[model samples]
Target: MTEASGDVRLTGISKTYGSFTAVHPLDLTVPQGSFYALLGASGCGKTTTLRMIAGLEEPSSGTVCLGEQDVTALPPYKRPVNTVFQSYALFPHLDIFENVAFGLRRRGIKSVKKQVGDMLDLVQLGEQARKKPHQLSGGQQQRVAVARALINHPKVLLLDEPLGALDLKLRRQMQLELKRIQTEVGITFVHVTHDQEEAMTMADTVAVMNGGRVEQQGAPAELYENPRTTFVANFLGTSNFIAAEVDSVSGDDVVLRAGDGKLLLPKARCGAATSPGGKVLLGVRPEKITLTHADDAGTVPDGRNRITGRVVASSFIGVSTQYVIERPLCDAFEVYAQNIERDTRLTPGADVVLHWNPAHTFGLDAGQDVQAGVEKVEEDA
Candidate 1:
């Protein structure tokens, strides 16, 4: 393979079907041999974007480049890429060995024994070579699909919700398996999925897509820790946003004034309203907050935002206790505290104080919808 073999780049690429635009003009580059994931909900254009890169759907405009070659107008078979769909798509009559070897045989390549054997071993299915798709479990069948795709030695591999059909336990197992296979082969893999956890677990880089555009793209931990948009703040994980107005901005520190309390936030963490007197939303992750009794508010140390509220509800979920605290800044502020000591004082209707370091807080533009990523549940009439 050439030095640029595994890199995939899309420059101003977009797709539209009839009057509807599936993907807006966007530019993205997937680094060589990196595991990348396109994440979003249904109709968010993630799959459409992936298809454009794979040559399955022609882009309305822009160029698709693999390595140094412009493969924008190339067909799926002409591009040096392979795809694994949600369905394994293996022939029922073909055994595992034949299925994996089929790709090589179709390309008129003879003597595929070593190549087929190596791929099967890579996916940990060497012993199951003789089994048909129907005879194997979902996980095993999925592995066969992977082996078939990898046997061709494509520069890039695209997975479209390949593990969506498996049960939760098997799905989790395959996630690790896929990551391991990608690392072993050293091929660029672009994965498309709506599952946030799957993207976080398997990909080295994740691009969060919405409304035909990428909202943000970065390392999973980076995006989760410091989300710039309201959608990202709520989509990747649970975030409790407190409405506040800017009171003062000095150097790297910006003070926010909530109802009767003051929140000191780092300017670098503020997504908007860097100047004073502007409206903004202060954000903190559920796990980053510490809960204390309302009576103990005075005992809390300085440099942390301390606010008293009543616990509206709480669920003891084995690993941690999740609480919904009703406060003046927001109707419901979620908090997750580990059951290390199992504070019995925190109960429904109990008064408590929520405190966390100023550095842990972030800010977002208040003009955007407060509940951008909340799942909408239909109520029965």
Candidate 2:
């Protein structure tokens, strides 16, 4: 074995039981000094994959590589990785300082004063050094767990839903703090999570797994903007898909006939093969659409993909108002309009027009189940 270079490489890694498969054979790479997330719903094999890398769960096939060293047969203690789980697992009898110094003391390092002090300060828990684990707040205790894990200075840190125990607000705050810590420490951080927002806000790269397979992997923004599958579009966020047929192929644009209206889609944005009369699904995020009262429909700008519908419901959600419109082909056409101008007439039983820039629309293969990811996150959220 060579010195660990801090990169985690998995080639054809898989996990299986007697008859059921947890993680299918897949290849993944976590570059040195990067934050990577494996995101998926419960029972989606994300946890199994993380455990395999930690040596807690053995892979049915393939090898686990830490940099150039293959540590497939090594025990968890021998691998150059420390895992921070949802449970802090701190020793209740020890103070914060001693808790972080436990790893060093176990290794027979006699003098642990400077090392423990520095670790506490690194995690901003220097002031809480004398406090016991049971006495600290949930967030503070979590920090102690992280400090303890980092004190070992492992080549990689594996986090398994470390923010699961935190409330929504605290979880969000921790997301930024973890990202800050990762940047400061500059080591490979492989995080496994079911929360889409947590993964999006923290990880530099995210691999979305489903049904024992990795559906897609990319930057959060990249995945959000150009999802190749309906499952990805709906799972990451909400997407309103409109059924359409290719009217013709114009210069750099694909003319689509959606219901009674003609829509234009960018050639590059279409993720499906297009031919004259071929069916496709035109997808647009709710926030990308502008909803206007039918009485004021004429004011909508030109060169925009437009749809005529009736307001079925409306909701005010603090920053923006979400409207559900009933339209041809698709009944629940959703739109999120910023609270810029109040339109009192845009209510249930009111006529409305939904419009958005054509460039914001993406075309998907019509054969895919449009509801593939709809409500799937609710299972774990």
Candidate 3:
């Protein structure tokens, strides 16, 4: 697959079914030749957004532009886009070569045989070119579908959960293979998926959607490390959120008093303009916290946040220990500790303190409804 120097722009694009809205007005941009992902839970509009880009579903409003051309009114077959669906949707009687050649042949492309041969080689399936769709394994069928879409050399390749039918191991392998193929083809890929890990691992930029709208968009690491909304924080990874009151503000750091009386986070986590007596939510990743012995009140490191709790449960997970610690005021907090030889000891029903760097905590505005917010947190966790 060679990278296409084509970018896609979606401006206020939306779709509706009579009175019901499937995709709210949304805006997005995919850089030329980048592997972009539309990621979210089911019913979050990721598939609808992808369909709009592929011209399978017409937008109820706004325009879709591929590179510099307005394609809002173009039909799927006429648009410079091709889709590889979750089911592969391969012709049962068609062999690998035929499947790859289908698109080119339908368009009356010249040198179809040579193009199909090149596509088979591109996907590393040349040896199985004569095997029928039923004779190939799930992963191989998926590769054929990809090659079929690539044979047309479309400006943008749209994949709708293309690896959903594969097993865990195959899915992981395909994530890498998909990245390689996207790079080789040099075509901008617009992928729709509900798998967070998949989006993070394969996408150059990820658009996190919710309630038919984009909640946030950024590179995987950027969104993971500095999530602006509570939804983004909870959805992207495991996060423990503690409710707190702004006790005071000093320079760039805001002093917050957690419900458990812990006054530890620095201004870096709370932002620069938080005022005294304001309410905020503090988020801490499980991996950032450490568990220490019940009686050990070792000197807390400078610029570190520390709190004490009783270990309610502990589970050994080979490489690390997962501990659920109950705080006096806040809900239980989870901590993951590496099973390093000397620090491997932890037991349920023991009292222990959790410590993490202050900079690792993120302060969020306390405007969201507590019930709805908590539900999202539990769902993501």
- Top model number, lDDT: 1
Candidate 2 achieves a global lDDT of 0.91
Task: List model 1 lDDT by residue over 122-176, tens digit each.
Answer: 9998999998899999999999999999888899999999999999999999999
Query: What are the lDDT scores of the predictions, listed in order?
Result: 0.92, 0.91, 0.84
lDDT of 2 by residue, 1-381 (tens): 233489899989999999999999999999889999999888999999999999999999999999988999999999999999999899999998899999999999999999999878877889999999988988888889998999899999999999999988888888998898899988889999988999999999999999889999999999998889998998899999989999999998999998778999999999987899999999999999988888888899989999888998999998999999998778498888889887889989999888999989999999999988776334654
**Greater-TM-score candidate between 1 and 2:** 1
Pairs that clash in candidate 2: none
Deviation in Å, model 3, residue 48 alpha carbon: 0.8
Candidate 2 residue-wise lDDT at 6: 90
Specify the poorest-scoring 10-residue window by lDDT in model 2.
372-381
Candidates in order, TM-scores: namely: 0.98, 0.96, 0.93
TM-score of 1: 0.98
Candidate 3's residue-wise lDDT over 14-102, tens digit each?
98999988899988889889999999988989999999898888899999988888989888888889999999999988888888888
